[model samples]
Target chain A: MQLLIGTQAVELDKEGFLKQLTDWNEEVAIKIAQQEHIQLTAAHWEIIELLRKFYQLYELSPSMRALVKHTEQTLGAEKGRSVYLLQLFPPSPAKLACKIAGLPKPLNCI
Target chain B: MTTNNKSITCKKLLFISRHAPYGTSLAKEALDAILAASAYDQNLSLLFMDDGVFQLLSAQDPSDLEQKNFAAMLPVLALYEIENIYVHFESLQARQITINELILDGVQVIDSKTICSLLTQQDQLLSF
Candidate 1:
């Protein structure tokens, strides 16, 4: 599938993960969020940046448990709970966060 | 990772394992898949039945078989936040296995009624 971001066509796999890692950016993130019917909020961007930074350091997307733990340690305990992330990203925070962050599908997300 | 115009939703995914470990790689592979799925942020439940219940036996020694001890992974599932592990009650009784003999903790022994209700509630079911 292809996502049109500001007239630029970005490719995605059948499963909706980014086909080209370099094709991701804030603009693409917005487009992807829009496709998911989520209007980007400041809170969402905060988690997205955190997820990208995590991927850069660990070379892997955080699992749900890891994401919650990292969020608690970095963002604070109030924000680390799955309930908080779920409220922001809806059902699957780890998978959706990675998708918006322009990272590969998190390992074991299938 | 799944994306679409539709809003994101949590999928209650159930994985059923009915094979014994070491005879083949099916047991380990199933556990691996479930662990991976746990990262996806879905509601995951793992059920062991039939010969699969033997996998939870404690003090498993694979030295004689020269195989990796895949049963060790059972305890680690909780770390992945996969806390909803279930074993068929009848399967255990048939195999002469007791709950105390299982190596892992926090496993729920479920009867067929509960299993059927769970099956009806799941959005997806994978059996291995």
Candidate 2:
């Protein structure tokens, strides 16, 4: 599958994650967020940025438990709770946030 | 009248990684299994012996091979609450690797006797 951003077509996996991580940009993230019914708020961007940094560091996406621990370590206790993340990216935060951040599906998510 | 009830217990799992990081998938597979088992909140520990000690070497760059650098994942183990990482003393001596060459912090270097006791303490052993 592919996502059309203006005139460019960005390839995506069947699960709507970006096929090429390099193809991701702010515009691409906004487009993906729109599809997921998220409005791309500042709070959302914070976690998205965190997930991207996490991928760069570990070369893999994080499971929900890892995500929570990482956020707690990096962003302090206030924004680390699952409830805080769920409020920003509802339903499933880790998977949805990773998708919007252009990372591959988390291996241990299931 | 009497009833029989079973109690839930967390098993002590020990993962023994014996392969080099890049040569086979065993190293990565063991790491993945360790992470997956962390969710269960069980007693988990890791031992790196044989060629597996290479997985903890610093400055590992697998970019050319298009594989994730296994050393990079070691730090995440602490975040998953799988902290008890151990390295075989003889393995490092055999490989001519020093303690500073390892990437992860707080790794307990143990001799064969300690390893023997560690094995005996585990409720289950998962070898890679």
Candidate 3:
């Protein structure tokens, strides 16, 4: 059983994924501000929020490779800098950022 | 020594980073947060593990790399009473750094166990 919001159907999960949303949001935001010298602008927030949504929907943070392709297509050209995202977050954005975001340090961060 | 109330009012920010100062913006950013919190009278501490220990390695030659001279900032931390600087023992051993090779005064060198203990004492922790 799942709930519906707008055109989308949100799944009701037996898994613990729902418990992690708030923590994941705050951690990644704070980390970006502290680690990358990024002030967490509205633009930056979009990526993490999208990542979290995708995580909740799919149960995993996307790979940088996956995220870049997704960001390029969805966010338009100004936001598709895989290199910039990597430079800003380092290694993998989904792994590190998502971990700080509190969704369980995406297995790849280590 | 002037930090926003955010630092002192909060329990602690256990900052962990693995990059050398000036290697990337991380060191400088960490310094800015520390100074901001210090201004607020926040008590802060740091541990340099892995590449981060390189930031404390004495006699930095920033001119050789054409980067800003940031080794100069390590000493001023004490002026702010931010005395809890620790460099991991294995990190130093792996890099062949002696206790004397680091530039900061009164810096502690501890094993992994001690570092783990310190983390447990902190109210909050962060990594970069």
Best by DockQ: 2
Please tell me which model should have the higher TM-score, number 2 or number 3.
2
Candidate 3 per-residue lDDT, tens place, B19-127, comes to: 7787588876666556446544455887888988888876876777766555665665654467788889999899898878888778888899998899987867777
Off by over 4 Å in 2: B1-9
Clashing pairs in 3: A24-A101, A24-A102, B2-B39, B3-B38, B3-B39, B3-B40, B4-B40, B7-B42, B8-B42
For candidate 1, what's the RMSD? 10.8
Interface RMSD of each: 6.8, 1.1, 18.8
How high is the lDDT of residue B18 in model 2? 96
Question: Which is better, 1 or 2, measured by DockQ?
Answer: 2
Clashing pairs in 2: none
Clashing pairs in 1: A108-B36
- Deviation from native of the Cα of residue B79 in model 3, angstroms: 1.4
TM-score of each: 0.54, 0.92, 0.48
Model 2 chain B: worst 10 consecutive residues (lDDT sum): B1-10
